[model samples]
Target: MGHFVIPVTGKPVDYVAQIFPKNNLIDHGVIVENAEVYRQANSDKIKVYG
Candidate 1:
């Protein structure tokens, strides 16, 4: 499986966790101040999760 790191903003980390299913989303948690990493499949067009 491919790996990727997606940066998210303006949204609760837990909410992101709930939105994206666990099967695809490996990690959806806070990385740093106002930043979160949504590790999933690599894609040229990433869904902007606010």
Candidate 2:
């Protein structure tokens, strides 16, 4: 599995609030956000890695 990281400009509580509507848990939201950011930040990397 690949690893991804998302930089959120807020505390965990704040990020959890923003993520609740889109996911069931804070960790899931973080993963989703990280995946998106990773895709945007390194499309070429994904292409090569995948």
Candidate 3:
């Protein structure tokens, strides 16, 4: 959503999205169904999408 820059040895370069970034993710349903567990949340914004 935003542009970023990364510093190399010489100069800073534009940051690009990586295809194989290390991440921890889970099923969307688990998040939606257990939304209440997020104590500090905007309940109105939580939604389930197909």
Candidate 4:
């Protein structure tokens, strides 16, 4: 799980955001923005999950 601090426009509240497992998977495991997009963009190299 990843944690992020988001700053609001005016409020003094501490807004936080959590990136889900699927979203975190991208650019991390495969270094791709999106699986399908990456696949369509790159056909020469096959996408494999580690």
Please provide, for model 1 over 1-50, each residue's C-alpha lDDT reduced to its tens digit, 9 standing for 90 to 100.
Answer: 46644546556444555444555554533332255333343322223335
User: Model 2, which residues run further than 4 Å from truth?
Assistant: 3-7, 15-50
Count of clashes, each model: 0, 0, 0, 0
> Which whole-number lDDT from 0 to 100 does residue 44 have in model 2?
28
Point to the candidate with the largest TM-score: 1
Model 4 residue 25 lDDT score = 30
lDDT of 2 by residue, 1-43 (tens): 3554443433332343444346433232232243333222322
Rank the models by lDDT, top first: 1, 2, 4, 3
Worst 10 residues of 4 by lDDT: 11-20
Report the alpha-carbon TM-score of model 4 versus the true structure: 0.17
lDDT of 3 by residue, 5-37 (tens): 321222111121121132322212113222322
User: RMSD in Å for candidate 3, one decimal?
Assistant: 16.6
Error of 3 at 25 (Å): 29
Stretch of 10 with least lDDT, candidate 1:
39-48
Show where candidate 1 strays beyond 4 Å: 28-33, 36-50
Mark the regions of model 3 whose C-alpha exceeds 4 Å error after superposition: 10-50
Best by lDDT: 1
Per-candidate Cα RMSD to the true structure, in Å, reads: 9.6, 11.2, 16.6, 14.7
Model 2 accuracy (lDDT, Cα): 0.33
